[model samples]
Target: MQLVDFFTLLFMLMGVVSAVLVAFHPNVLYAAVALVFSLLSVAGLYGVLGADFLAAVQLIIYVGGIIVVILFAIMMSENIYRARFRDAAGKFVIPTAVAALLIAGFLKLFHDAKLETRAGLNAIPTTEQMGRALVGPYALVFQYVAIVLLAGLIGAVVVARPHHGNPESEAEKK
Candidate 1:
């Protein structure tokens, strides 16, 4: 196989493994860290697919901004490290059914699709076009996303803040 193909497979494997870790890891902090690796793998896939802008955005927005905020929130919260998640055995049936259906649908779609190999598939830099679209046609959507992100950040800060007024009591509680 070619080098690019090898890298593609490696990134795909990394993404899949990290995603499993994100889902199954009991420690919330460890799961968040695994999520970072998963996001990084996705960014690598975007890079391989020649979507440089998307790769950068994935790294910047997800790994850099969102994950950092999540880690900080987890770290700042009291007793979160001692928290344990309980498995809800009864709740898995519906989600498992939906996942099975989705997997089957995807398999069928791939089986029915006609994929042809193309020569001279050059990587086109889409940064300029993407920037223009975001500023021109999708300006409102971009602004709305920014607003939502800002609100989430504020909410995280509020939720992570100590409830009690007395500093000595807060330390004792921790």
Candidate 2:
């Protein structure tokens, strides 16, 4: 097999194994670490597929931003570290059945679909094209997304700030 194919398989395996670990691990901290590995492997798969922009976004948004936030939240909550989570008996049966059904349906769809294969298509750099598109035709949409993100950030800050307006809280502080 080619190097790219080998890397693709490796990333696929890593992603699957890590995802399983994330789902089944008893320790929440270990599960969180496994989640990181799973996300990173997905980013690697995106890179292997020549979707450089998607890979970067996956690394930046999911791995960097979301994971960091998750880790921070986990670390900040003292009760989570002391808590032992246990699943009820037979809890996995329904979800497992649903997942199996979905997998079977997807497999049937793939088997029935007539997919067109294009040959000799080069992996072009999408960063420049995306940048131009963001600033050119899709500028408004891009600006809207930025504005929404900024608003969310401001809202989060507002919500997280200490509410010192209550007389009870002020008395407790004194």
Candidate 3:
């Protein structure tokens, strides 16, 4: 196969490994690190697929911002790491077998499905075309998305603040 294909395969393998570690690892901190690695590899795969802007957004939003917040939250949590309280890890046999069967069934269904050909529409999508679509036609939608992000930021602050001295706690004191 071509070099790009080889890189794509390697990146996909890394993502799979990271996902397994994230899901099965016992240590929550290590799992968070694996999750970050998985997100980074996904961003790389987006770059390999020629989604330049998507890759940047993935790196910035997922790897740079969300994962950091996740890791910090994991670190700040006071009671999650006690070994005595950690539940016994469950056996994986039945759930894994079911998941494998479901995946195989989905693959079979996808193989049997056929796409219907439709009338011609313009298919070329370069950066300039994407820019025109985003700004010229979808500017309002983009602004709405920005507003949503701002609301998310405000919500994060509201949720993360220490509420120890709030009126509810004061009422409990009385």
Taken over the whole model, the C-alpha lDDT of each candidate is 0.86, 0.85, 0.80
Order of models, best lDDT first: 1, 2, 3
Q: Candidate 2 on 1-174: residue-level lDDT in tens?
A: 888879989999999999999878876777889999999999998787777999999999998899998889888878675544454446878978999999999999999998543224356777898899999999999999999999999999999766788787677778
Clashing residue pairs, candidate 3?
none
Residue 110 alpha-carbon offset, candidate 3, angstroms? 5.3
**1-174 per-residue lDDT for model 1 (tens digits):** 877788888999999999999877877888999999999999998888778999999999998899999999999988876664434546777977998999999999988987533235567888889999999999999999999989999999989777788787699788
Q: All predictions: root-mean-square deviation over Cα? A: 5.5, 3.3, 5.9
The reply for model 2, stretches above 4 Å from the true place, is 79-85, 97-121, 162-164, 168-174
Give the best candidate by lDDT. Answer: 1
Off by over 4 Å in 1: 86-90, 108-121, 135-174
Candidate 2's displacement at residue 94, Å, is 4.6
Ranking by TM-score: 2, 1, 3
Number of the predicted model whose TM-score against the real structure is largest: 2
TM-scores of the candidates in the order shown: 0.69, 0.77, 0.68
